[model samples]
Target: AQLFFISNGLSVGFASIQTLTDKSTGLKKGIKGDLTTLRPTIMTAVPLILDRIQNAIESTINKSRFARIFFAIFFSQKKFWSYYGLDTPLINLIFCRKFKAALGGRVKIIACGGAPLSPETHQFIRNCFDLKLLQGYGLTETSASATIMSLDDTSVGFVGQPLDGIQIKLIDWEEGNYKVTDKPNPRGEIVIGGHNVTNGYYKNETLTKESYKEENGVKWFLTGDIGEMFPNGSLKIIDRKKDIIKLSTGEYISLAKIEAELKKCPFIANVCVYGDSSKEYVIAFIIPNASHLKSLADKLSKSGLSFKELCNDSEITAGVLQSIRQIAKHSKLHKVEIPNKIKLCSEEWLPENNLVTSALKLRRKNIQDFYQKDIHLMYGNEHKP
Candidate 1:
């Protein structure tokens, strides 16, 4: 994105930790920085960064009685009007303007990609800023130019139709039981055929043969992502083909989907949901949200404990596991889909640790290897078949 702006003769400024963080709390304050230095009109971020900002904003609002009451009244009003394709300028000026100032006071466009943005966070951002948080979909192979939500798109959850000259199709994946012929909306593996599609991977013929194909003179890339097509032709990425694991009971679980849903729990900062094909249930390795966990610890009379100690505290672990189960159930996951146990980690999964990608996507195999012992304990000596 920075390169694109620079090539187009636009000035691009990078945000650093010093500029994005609040000195007092050490939490990201979004784009809140010295406006005189760089008041950006457009911004792009990954879902993880945006989620952190949302948490910071919510935490601040919760700390003050006045701010809480003020936001409650106006937030509902803005949400109501937004449903009718209306803008509440009065509400924006009165209630949201201050919040907008925290984002440099001039950001008119905010784009989020890299990972799925939760519906709750999506709505919260739009309602707070009175601007559409455009959700886009693409991968490094597509030059990050596949689909993007239009400015006028008021709906949520769907990444908009393909960009010009980009063609998208869905193919059936029998093992996952997703089909292009499925009910109200067709669901299947996404295939992109267009100029944007790369020819093949560099110096890797084996991977190239497996992932790339050509038909009728147009090269196509089989994007291992599973997507659902809305009646309006928008695509909602629903799962990753590689992330599906079949259990001993013959039930297939989308590990990425489960992790995404579980991350919505306020107590969970990040999670890796693991399943053994020979086992019937899944387990999760979680990085707890420190602030929220501290609050939980306080309630359990375990305050004054260090973060590491809190992670090991039986009561805290049980509390977080219960919250994860509640969120899983509320998300309507199957009984087997809900994690059977959880292990809390005091350390975060960072790219440097090889537990997650630069984009913050889970490196499942690496994470499982890193937590092998904990996972074994969670499963309790179930012999592999």
Candidate 2:
């Protein structure tokens, strides 16, 4: 397989990020052009990038009335069902080619990492591109990826098993109340020891000592990530050990998982799930998907409403919250895990706002602080839905 690298050089030790800019000069194009013109066979990206790509395809499809109707009519047919089965080649040859063409028509596989991709987004991309989305798991401490899904692996909801030469173990985290001795799926903090694993944090002795521990003669790095080991040996990350918070009712909640599920709502573009030990139920700060919101407003004959007005509208808020509940229900999230109060924001979270990391993961604390007033207002009321 041929590989082409495109990056700001973060992986290769180019730490001077000030030199990077989006300006396209001469014959070289920007990131958008590079992806669409270079026609790469395999692409590696975070799930957020994949989400944008999926959104673009969906937007294009929605632009064509005939295409939208065709898809709606055919998606329920046996032909599309076969696409989910072994006879997918025909599906790609017929329906998926147009979507593939949008991606320079050559990408065969996309390797997604950095953050958890919602299963809804995962299946949409696979069906649209007729390409396998291979999920990998790792952190900077593990020297990139410790495990990558194989080409033939089609499993959903879990990252892959450990890579060769890497040893992984789960230790019970008493604070999170996760015990390896639990029945069915046992979850705990992932401990990794491998040649690829970093020795310790540079020039930080206290941090190094706290994160890296010696069990017997083997040295292992505590990932701080909570994960469940399936019967099939695949690992599914549930949340960060440090990020898990116990609600006032004494129920533990994974904010990351809740946010991921909330993002599956069509009307929500981005979300930040916030809760504290004192809060009984979680609250969400959401950025509505502009196009989906417009569609909803059009149906409601409220198309002239401004972004802020639309966000605050009772009808719009009720509809979006209902969608979020449906997604949570489909994900089988507990009632405690669902956000009982939601506040919508018109501003999109961008790097300039410092609300998201470079990999597009939410800076949860920052977002919560940014929306503190709105959150207070939501709680000031009963916050039904």
Candidate 3:
């Protein structure tokens, strides 16, 4: 992105995470701080960064009862007008301007990629900032360009249509029961064929042949990502082929999908859902949001405990599990899809720890190995619903 901007004669500035989040440096200049100093009109970020911004804004708003009430009323009003293809400038000026100022007050666009942004966060950003928060979909093999949401698109959850010269096709996955012939919307594995697709993996002919193919003289890359096509030509990624696991009851669950949904819960910062074919239920390893965990501890009258102790408190664990179940139900997950047990941890999974990738994607095998004991203990007392 920086190269593209520079090639186009646009000036680009970079800021490290330390520069942005370091309280000593940022707070010294006032609330807006370095971002306000930059005053950037356009920004690009991953879903993780965007999620943090959303969480921070929510945390600030929730600190005051009147602020929460004011935000709720205006948010609804703005959302209502947005549905009719209208803008509430008054609401933006009065209610959202303060929130927008935290990001420099000049941010006109935010492009999000790397991971799927939850529908709730997507809408929250759009309404709160009153700016274009475009969600995009792509992989490194495609040179990081594929589908990007249009600025005029008001819908949430869909990644939008393909880019110019990019062609997409969906093939049925029989084992997963995703079909291109499904009613209302065609669902299947996404395959990309275009000039942007890579020729092959270097010195790995077997993997290259398995994932890449030529049909009708066009090279295609099988994404292994399940998608549903809308009547308007938009695409919504629904699952991942590699993330599907079957339970003892013969029901298949998409771990990626469930994790995405559960992350919407305020208590959860990150989670890994695990299913055993020998068991009828699933279990999860959760990394709790530190601020939210502290709040939870306060609510349970268990304040002053260390982070590790808070994680192990039986009441707190049970409370968090209840909250997770509530969020899963709200997300319309099946009964079996809701994890039967969860083990909360104070330690975050990071690339440095080898529990997650640099892109923040879970290194499933590493995470499982790291928490094998917790997994066993949770499953030992598992009961089928």
Candidate 4:
């Protein structure tokens, strides 16, 4: 049986902060792993948790009452889910059990970052584990975190407002315009200004000049992420500028976000999405999380479904599509934002394989470069639809 339970949130509420470290972020501020004693009053996570919960609905629901219960989450955290542009934040806490024990048995707030926190993950963790996860946003240039939701008064996925002394604005940056002024909150690159922000990339002045600019009486560092400011002054991140992938159909895509979702699959450890306008469809190379893969096998057998048969079945492929569709619906993403193709494999995207960072983050550009030919073939005609 696929067992689920509530563990203490603080245990992991700040325990496994593996994703906090950035290599270019300099050694002092960068994290090699989760902080044990130096517990964060608030911790952030990605949207992958919500992503796996969505996949679980299709892959192993088994017509049980649990099917309806699990599916119900898609509609519940609507606003919360849309906060990070990946609407399924509720489910992020489904498998985050180990965290329950490690938090020195005490914690303050859980900050869901990277992507959006689904409403399910937020409310579920709060009610079940007694841990409140507040969604927030920031970037590397801003030194990892720029703004956080107020713990005393927080809503699911709001990302709250900006921090004290930090500045933000929107600009008219549509290729033709380089020297333009500010806009309140249009969907342009999120620009930042604050002491916390990095001065510039080490030895990369031109790139820095292109990224940093003066706006609204302060020097602002440009983050390639696309976002909007609410009239209430809260900030929400939606997508990345570098992630604007144009498909073969001339449809622009966000493979970065797409791959991030796939990585959320409990079964997924590493994933890479590749497709250009020269390609009919985008393709992914996935490395499954071993434990999650085993759980899949268990879930299949208990449900009287053949793992082997389902693995190769067209129904399985279609199920993957439906799961992704539900995620897109929950996330409130555009049509081109979704990825239609995936290549699932039991092998992990290992650090030794150069597919992951030492901290186990997927190196997207590296993965594509190394497996360029294989990725092309997966999106090719030979594979069964």
Candidate 5:
């Protein structure tokens, strides 16, 4: 496969594929490392890594106030002219040269999988790299990719139709109250059936039975992934079935959706939104963008606090929370959807620390347990409901 795969390297059997492996710990090396090392033309990475690469590039340009403003104006118009492919020449002349040097100027395709990629970030990478970013969708039980975007697909958020042999369908999930009848698009639990789909678990009959269903002689796998089918025949993953929690008021909340919207704020590096039947409202644990926080502190004449101390400063804390609210507002989130409480943390979640999955997804239960004290404080010690 000539694909540069970035992952924990334990999951998925891509080790034998011809690929470039990062010697260091992060996706940042993709931007900082010499691409001449492998002369890679294709890359497969999680959306988190792609976001990190975008942030790194933006940060580098932000170092120069003039360059920052220059890009701000350029991209503002690029967003309009991009539809006609008029933005490429200027972008190549100004930014692509430096970026190309880092990657040996040979990258033609980047396949993103493992997590939901925001449309904005997807487009940013496309505009910057001037390459096709194919997004793939699947689960471990489905073998690998059940669906993949076409090489010509530049649209984001949608993972496109299923593979040739894969048969995909949606069924209503009562717990989530999601159905195909609800709106501009149809959404429900995605079910997959095909030769590529596993028949059953080796010895775990209970799980195998619960996860599979027979329909017209085909054993369909219940993917537990909620998705929306578009008029264009594309599929957009909405949230995981397990990630949806019902509040004490009986309102269903998708933690994944909330976290995705919160992460949209430039000041937020990472965030995990939590709520359960015991809680009346949502709460968030946030890891701030250190550089962005520092810039904010400098602008406010509070640079003395430092990134760690700034997390505890009342004013800085308030500012970060407000930025999150603004981002939520821009996303048209309901008042109930906005987090009622938020806790700031300085440490970034990493696979090494087990705070994140190999795919870079947050370990929600572990995070909640680790912040039990803070969570308790947020919902008063005596308020257990």
Candidate 6:
């Protein structure tokens, strides 16, 4: 019916959504949205749009579920009921697309890129909506396009193989652990070389040298992502080399690990897990999948876990909290890795809100700065969500 894409943590296309807004909009809030009037079947975008669609659907069909979704999203100090109501009419309006028999369904295929789309979201779209949903992996460095997951080979874990003429190879920056990196299915840096890779950054040769690595006449552009090449010749991203958090215990944790785990839950929308063992604690900013959260709420209500009764400070069904803990265990994540203290932030981080980027990447630095005070307060307080 409609497509929404977003990224606020990484620089997939360069320049966060805020810096690239049309000057004529004359608004400092940033890019509002990329909603299309035409019914879109083959919609492609980053992960954020999926988050919005989930919330919009929840707000309309399930009020209790909507409360839970926004609760996880804002993680505010008991800020669930106060959120605005559902938009079921909007979802119905969008879903009822006119289609000829030749077109198969209202929306046939959905493609996602800019950043990794959560496996939960991908499967939800496919199973619930009965549409072919695909994920793409690439960045602006590679001319903003590279590998794609087409219908014939949409595996669960892989980012699919490279597009035509795109040469991919895994290289070890550290020779001592070359064997670990060299393992056929082990994680290593994703290096791409093709006509699409940019030659150099404008007047930034040092960066050019750092980004455009070479060996034995082979020119490769480093993607800074750690991924394993599957035995089936598929690609699975493992972590971001730049996103590792060093716990004081000397154990390195991947932020994406926490993110990936949270996404596996059916009710979560956007999850950004961070914090170093410098404090040895982990917290997350969660945006719940509003629609899914509602169904979960209904089921939980039967079990005596009501959103309003769950907390005196806020009204989030314990189902939301319980679901998160269950996800961590199921994913075999560390106990400390689970976010005990969460702030339900409902407002979808938009470009117009100065939260996302155009190419649908997260401006993490910007978000951190934007929520610095709240994060500090959350961290300083002894309470755990």
In the range 272-368, model 6's lDDT, one tens digit per residue, is: 7657466677777766665565466555454354333332224363566677899889889987778767665666666677766765566676777
What ranges in model 6 sit over 4 Å off? 1-37, 51-105, 173-184, 215-218, 264-267, 288-322, 381-385
User: Candidates sorted by TM-score, descending order?
Assistant: 1, 3, 5, 2, 6, 4
Q: What is the TM-score of each candidate against the true structure?
A: 0.93, 0.82, 0.92, 0.64, 0.86, 0.67
Evaluated against the true structure, the overall lDDT of model 2 is 0.76
Please, what is the whole-model Cα lDDT of each candidate in the order they appear? 0.85, 0.76, 0.85, 0.56, 0.78, 0.60
| All models, RMSD in angstroms | 2.6, 5.5, 2.9, 10.0, 4.7, 11.5
Q: For candidate 4, give the lDDT of residue 272.
A: 68
* Over 4 Å off, model 4: 1-105, 115-120, 175-185, 215-217, 257-270, 289-340, 350-354, 357-361, 381-385
Task: Give the lDDT of residue 11 in candidate 6.
Answer: 19
Q: Which portions of model 3 show Cα errors greater than 4 Å?
A: 16-34, 381-385
Candidate 2 lDDT over 203-273, as tens digits, reads: 99999999998767677889999889988778988779766888889888888878777776767777888
Candidate 5 error regions (>4 Å): 1-36, 62-65, 73-91, 102-104, 300-302, 383-385
For model 2, give the 10-residue run with minimal summed lDDT: 12-21
Q: Name every residue pair that clashes in candidate 2.
A: none
Tens digits of lDDT, candidate 1, 1-385: 7877999998887764235534323345443454325777887777877677777787778879998998899999998899888978899899888777767777888898988888888888888877678999998888888899999888888888899999999999998889999998999999998989897899999999999999999989999999999888899999998999999999888998898888788887788899999899998988887789998999999998999999999899999888888888899999999998889998878788999887778898899888888877889887442
Rank by lDDT, descending?
3, 1, 5, 2, 6, 4
Tell me, by TM-score, which candidate is best.
Answer: 1
Backbone clash pairs for candidate 1 read none
lDDT over C-alpha atoms for residue 225 of model 1: 96
lDDT top scorer: 3
Error at 70, model 5, angstroms: 2.9
TM-score of 4: 0.64
